[model samples]
Target: MSLLTVKNISLAFGGPLLLDGAELTIRDGERLCLLGRNGAGKTTLMRVLNGDLPPDGGDIMRRQGLRTALVTQDVPADLEGTVFPIIASGLGEQAALLEEFHQVSRSLQSSTDPALMERLAQLQKRIEETGGWQMQQLVEQVIRHLKLEGDAAFAHLSGGVKRRVMLGRALVSDPDLLLLDEPTNHLDLETIAWLEDFLVRRDKALMFVTHDRSFLRRVATRIVELDRGRLSSWQCDYDTYVQRREEQLEAEEKQAAEFDKKLVQEEKWIRQGIKARRTRNMGRVRALRQMREERRARRERSGTADLAVQQGERSGRRVIEAEHISYAWTGQPIIRDFSTTILRGDKIGIIGPNGSGKTTLLQLLLGRLKPDEGRVKLGTNLEIAYFDQHRGQLDEDRSVQDNIAEGNDWVEINGQRKHVIGYLRDFLFPPERARSPVRTLSGGERNRLLLAKLFTRPANLLVLDEPTNDLDLETLELLEGLLVDFPGTVLLVSHDRAFLDNVVTSTLVLEGEGRVGEYVGGYEDWQRQRAEQIEDEEKKPQAAAEKVQPQRPGRDRPRKLGFKEKRELEALPARIEELEAEQATIHEQMANPDFYRDHGDEVAQLQQRLEQIARELEQGYARWEELEALEG
Candidate 1:
């Protein structure tokens, strides 16, 4: 069933049209992921679909009584109140009565004054008279479903939790369609994973715009892209969509080339002499004029960001070394007995829950915060450029060009001088946009500005804290490529699984209780190794119990492993290595851009084989450990 349909929708600001005759049908039970460049009017289209913004032209047909809710990109600054009232606000007209009833009811729980009880009774009577009982129940249910405390102040919640509150507010109305813009912007890995699971399990229709590729892959049933003021739907997953979209762009370019060639020939013929302008050729002249108009109106795709990292003089082999570092906040251990050595050219990812001190760890390593009990040593000639997740490095009051050039007309990159506007253009900023105040820029543009600013200086050490936030997939992948090829060491703090998997060589996971575990490989690798470690730990208790227990009088000693089992145990290491080797080979094969185009069908098979190999290697390692424990 279709919940809403947009037909011939066109919207325009003062400049180019944002949505030019865009058409879409949002059906029930479909999760559509909206993809586009930063300023391609994705949010505007979302707003139009939600009926918050009226399109300049076209019709939107909604099923009778169909409800829709939207969570905007940024939380409204003036949104205030406890969680319950905020959620109840979704119930139009009866929200005040329900809020008063809730407040009076809670007051009576603590103080059973006659006045309080009377007020509560009166409020309840009003709520019942207005037939808001079901709506009240819905408000509570949404809070419970979202795991939010009904009485907690919305102002006190973390950004992620605040987003959840907003989501709950949207859901309280039991909307038929939910539209979210950049839903994963401030979410941590655990919260993102939980949200992915939650949305996948929900039956409602969802249309979300997100830069998180992993979240998009797991949640989207279909992919829709907004490009050059037009919407294109891809009925496939993100990876397949990438391949097909590339092929589409290539075909469009070829057709455009042929059209341009024909237009040139027509121009040459029309310019050639008096015979072409004769009475019989008047129709041809009119056709050429139409072709010129068509060519003038064509909107080409926006250019990709040109990103480069300037390299400084080589740093010492040892970039940073922390010895038995212990840090505490409010007398609680955040990083305890954590120690590691970072070398040049090493890319490390730091991951943890929202408040689990990922940034604290980064500060400790950078010698910004003194460890309470241990020492951190920094290497020599380590010129550092940091990408702050909060974007604190950027000046909001200054124009984008001024922020980068600092009132100068030119800036130096890698010892070469470039004009400020030209440099901003490399980041996809036009002259007008580059002159706009930083505060007026979108989140993606702000992030790009920060990158442009950071890359201006030569640095041998790059410390990025959640640098992928608000970046488009194209820009994010470009940054990934830059990091991968960077000659210096990188300390990246990101929750983006794909980015981490693509760029980092190792991971530092902040397990609870002040334990920081180091693991080789990326996010998926850590998951596999951690799962195996947990399995080994779970088996240790049973193995110990068997060893300590007294033997039965008639039972023979625990039977030794058979010849086949012993052979299997001994060969497990070699088998695990073989599987790992194959996994690496597959990864290498898939890394090339040409791989998707050349061997598209093999991608899924390769992914399945990787999973199979991981499982087998995990089982083999576990079995080997089990056998060794028994033998001991």
Candidate 2:
């Protein structure tokens, strides 16, 4: 059964119609992915479906009492208070009572005041009467599943966590149809994977807009595209959809060409003087008029972005070298004793969890932030262009053209001069939009604008931090191709798995506890190597145990421990305890804010000792078990 049906939806703004007779039917258990170019009305259609914005003309029929929930791309600025109450607010009418009850319960835990006790009892009775227990349970369940702290302030959370909280709020409603826009925008690789698993396991229908191709392939059961104010349904996987959509566009182009050829012939005949007009049939004349109207009404597809990188003169062979670099922030180590040599033309990808200091690492390499311990050396004649994840280089109050050309009418790229408007057109920006303020542009458009701004400058090195956030897939693939073919060195920091796999030649992964591991390939290659390393580590103890207690043929009795072995076994527990005690002391010291400020020189030495202790404890426990089994 269909949960919702949209018929002949027509929506228009001042300039053009955003949705012209768009039709859709969302069925149960359907996971649909909405795709389009940057400004092709994908988000507008989402708003229309959620009923937040009504279409100018449309009839929307819903299953009786059906519920729908929408998670917008940007978190609301007004969402304040603790996480529990914020999420419980999704329950509508029962939210206030639930929040009051929760507050009273928590207060009674610290104080035995009779007033608090009475309020709690009254709130519980009202909740029971209103059948709000299920809603409360649902709120708790969502908190646990999302791994959110109920008491944590929503405003204090990171962008990724805030997105998750928003998702939890939507999920708490238990809606039959869920709509998500750019769900994977700020999420890291680990969180993206978790969300993928969660959505795939979920039973409800989903309609979402995303630029992450990997997430689209994993979660979408069907693909739908909004192009030129029309909705197209592709009942296949993402790869198949790409192939079929190309073939479709080709066929449409061919058909349009034939129509134009015949229209031209008719126009030529009609333009002939009175001689032709005397023989012209009335029906053919009306048909020719209709053809002219049809041609005028046609909405041609927008052109793709024409992206190019301006390469600077080649730098020296070596690009950057870091020897045993260590950086700490408020006593917490971001990178410890990490060393790597980056040569020219090395496309290195930096990846880690959000707040794990990927940006800090980039700053360290680019000589922006000084390392506390070791040194970062730069090669000669290096020219660098950086694309910040926060889009800090863009002035929001400035017009798009002014931001690019800085009030100049013309700009130079690679020794060639072009008008600013003409250059912006290559990035799909019309003259009017180019004159608009940067704040008015959409996220994808802002990203494109940033690329346009960045590519204008000549650079021997490119550092992109989360450049794929709001780009359409076509633009993203185009960027991948550009990076792969660029002769300059590149350092990219991104959470996009597919982008990393396609562009980077190596990866710098920030494992926890200040460990940075360098791998030879992209995201998947790193995963394979890490898995193999773990498998090898797990087999080491077993292999040692087997080697120590080799069995002879026809031997029925187990070997007893020698005197030295007994002493070593008896001493193992004390040694393990001593190691653990030292480890705990080190951790306590590291947690103090003043530790790094006062004893910054000793940070690396202490970290190395802690690692050594961990290894010793592991070996001691393994040996003790082996001896105990032999004695038994």
Candidate 3:
């Protein structure tokens, strides 16, 4: 059942071997996730499988009649067609027989040839097998799933949209094998979920490389790891992969430690025995040297992820706030009468659909975007830095060192003004790569460059937009470690499930279009709410239930309610309204230009206090509803 048997595959870009003697055996209906650090030949291996790139040394034996469609990251946006026409490319194999019929009809009119008559029947039969005119209908069904039905020009769309269109084109073809490289990179959560279900139910074999941990867990049944020029498979999800890889590494470490002890004992004994080198001693000495080399190699082969986040200055309670802001583009609203706040050291994860204006909201808080209707205000003591997908602030033509050091009067490392070369070296930038242009650096490297700049400046508040994109596994781990321990306030907008789970302190669910629903806890709590919401959606809500269902008493729950409790419950809704009104007043003040110009320092503090009040107000409302339902 092995559909692809790639034996001893070797691929190289220029000098170093990108993939050295790699081997893979993939069978039909196998779902594989390919993992490796950046520049580890993940994309290259996929190219080799899809026949876009040939291996320098190795025989690839593919089963006959095996067709493949690749949703590559580099799927050229220059596809010479409109969005509708590009999707129509999926129906390429079934060229209509109309032209053939027209030619044959003309020829038949000229001469009644028997050979021409037979050719016409064969062409008609082939077209009939391909579903005739129904191929376009199939194409429409698949492309609609991608949500690009009425798009005018594929070429003029954003990078995310074009990626979607390309994926639709590849997926609609119904190939025997599918190669998806970072397939979920540009997709929203709903689209990703749809893709996962499709992959799970598909009959075709699939192999993809993606950083989305949740997507991989749902889609992949097998894991393929490539490291140090070798391939290994794990028949488990990404979560299990992490668990098993750690366990295996621990075993290897223990074995290595035991070997080292034996080597040391032998080395010590050998040194103790000879000032005079006898012929017998010489043989023992040579054996000990070889053992030492093996031990050294083993120690070096182990991988480690390390990080050090410098302690930040004490920040005040007020962190970030946006007030009564309304923004629009092309006469359509993105954020309307929107107000939100984050407290000191708050790690908030912003979630929304791709075009629902998550990035624009981030810009509004970062002082980059101006609201048409209302002014923006920030705390006086707050220091902020942002990370986005494009890494736009980086000078594309400049070197890594130059990009990092730009505009800074002097960069101090260990209390000295660091030389440009040395600064890049500290960030793990190789010396030879110091002179390379910024544009030449890969996605992962550019992110690292941005990190270096951020840390050197060392802001007290960090606003990150899709910070997980293009970061290698090692770098991501290092970043997670730093973010966990850092004292700075963080407002993150990311599609990366694992990253949010690991680092966030709260979740901001952008539901009801662009409106914000704040939740306590982190990604775990958000997931619980989402599940509850989904269940609510599926169930028909009864009017009796809407009255308010009784739940445990506040945080001090499970107590029996008396007459006083009943009266208190009746008054709770009014109190909730009062808190909401107060929050509105604070929001209005923060939005005023006078407040920012004269009382900038007090503005952030007021917002933080307002957030605490808002949470209590929401809880009160929920409690009131619960009591009302119970009474009904």
For model 1, what is the alpha-carbon lDDT of residue 32?
A: 99
Number of the candidate with higher TM-score, 1 or 3: 1
lDDT by residue for model 2 over 1-632, one digit each (tens)?
Answer: 89999898989888788998899999999999999999889989988888899999979888998888999877888989999999998888789998997786566445656565555556656776787766776677567656689899999988768887898888777688999999887777877886787689789989999988889999999998998888989999999999999999999999999999999999998889998889988899999999999999889998888888888999999999999999999999999999999999999999998778999999999999999999999999999999987889999999999999999999898899999999999999999999999999999999999999999999999999999988988888899999999999999999888889999999999998899999998998899778666545544565576575533323334345655567788998998899989987875675454554565555556645754776576568769888889778
By TM-score, the best candidate is: 2
Clashes of 1: 0
Tens-digit lDDT track of model 1 for 189-283? 87677678768978989999988898999999999999988888999999999999999999999998998999999999888767656744788
What clash pairs does model 1 have? none
Predicted structure with the largest lDDT when compared to the true one? 2
TM-score of 1: 0.81
Give the C-alpha miss distance for residue 470 in model 2, angstroms.
Answer: 1.1
Alpha-carbon runs more than 4 Å astray in model 1 = 91-109, 114-152, 155-162, 546-632
TM-score of 2: 0.83
Q: In order, how many clashes per candidate?
A: 0, 0, 3
**Local distance difference test, candidate 1:** 0.85
- Cα lDDT of model 3 by residue, 492-520, tens digit: 88878778888998887666444667777
Task: List residue ranges in candidate 3 displaced over 4 A.
Answer: 95-129, 132-138, 149-151, 251-312, 406-428, 512-514, 522-524, 530-541, 545-632
Per-candidate Cα lDDT values, in order, are 0.85, 0.86, 0.72
